[model samples]
Target: MTPERFAECLASLRWTAIDLTSALQCQLSWIEAMEGGQAEIPEDLARWLESLAKCHEAAGIPSHYRGVAQF
Candidate 1:
């Protein structure tokens, strides 16, 4: 995903770079770089985001509510 979209996904999940990094066991700089467009988003990170979205859905969080603008 594009950096902007990744950032939006994080916002939708109520997460920051710090949160993602901690959850994914990656460096904060890596998450920041990806979100800032300084580096390409890793495949693992993309998959993690997708999985997290699915989990949220399974938890009954509506898509509309999880959108960036909703919070």
Candidate 2:
């Protein structure tokens, strides 16, 4: 994903790594790697993040708060 877009997602999520990891059902290290752009975001992780964002939106979060995803 474009770095800017990734940053946007992070911002929307309020930098809550623990919460995001729980939402994505992944380890915090995984989320940290992806957010820090240290590890290449695999397709699965990308999909996971997308699904998590959708879930958040469905739970009454604003759609506009969601960000574009990339692998």
Candidate 3:
């Protein structure tokens, strides 16, 4: 996904970069790279986020993760 679309996805999901890094159990730098267009967003991740966004819109997923500390 392009950086713009990736950002849009995050907004749709009500996720900040920190929230996403926490949700995905990934490093913030990786999220940054993806957001900054320095790294190609893996297709699996793009697809995953797309599906997750749909779920989010339906309120199928929790608004935030429980028991996960925010950095």
Q: Please give, for residues 7-32, the per-residue lDDT of candidate 2 as tens digits.
A: 56656556577877787688989777
Q: 48 in model 2: Cα distance from truth in Å?
A: 6.5
After superposing candidate 1 on the true structure, give the runs of residues whose Cα lies further than 4 Å from its correct spot.
Answer: 54-71
Candidate 1 residue pairs in backbone clash: none
* lDDT of residue 46 for candidate 1: 84
Q: Let me know the TM-score candidate 2 reaches against the reference structure.
A: 0.50
- Candidates in order have lDDT scores of 0.81, 0.67, 0.91
Score residue 5 of candidate 3 by CA lDDT.
89
Q: How close is candidate 3 to the true structure, as a TM-score?
A: 0.74
**Candidate 2: which stretches are off by over 4 Å?**
13-15, 44-71
lDDT of 3 by residue, 18-70 (tens): 99999889999999999999999999999999898877777755656988898
Stretches of model 3 off by over 4 angstroms after superposition: 57-71
In candidate 3, which residue pairs get closer than 3 Å at backbone N, Cα or C atoms, i.e. clash? none
Q: Relative to the unseen true structure, what is the Cα RMSD of model 1?
A: 6.6
Residue 2 lDDT in candidate 1:
91
Candidate 2 whole-model C-alpha lDDT, 0 to 1: 0.67
Per-model TM-score on C-alpha atoms: 0.68, 0.50, 0.74
TM-score winner between candidates 1 and 3: 3
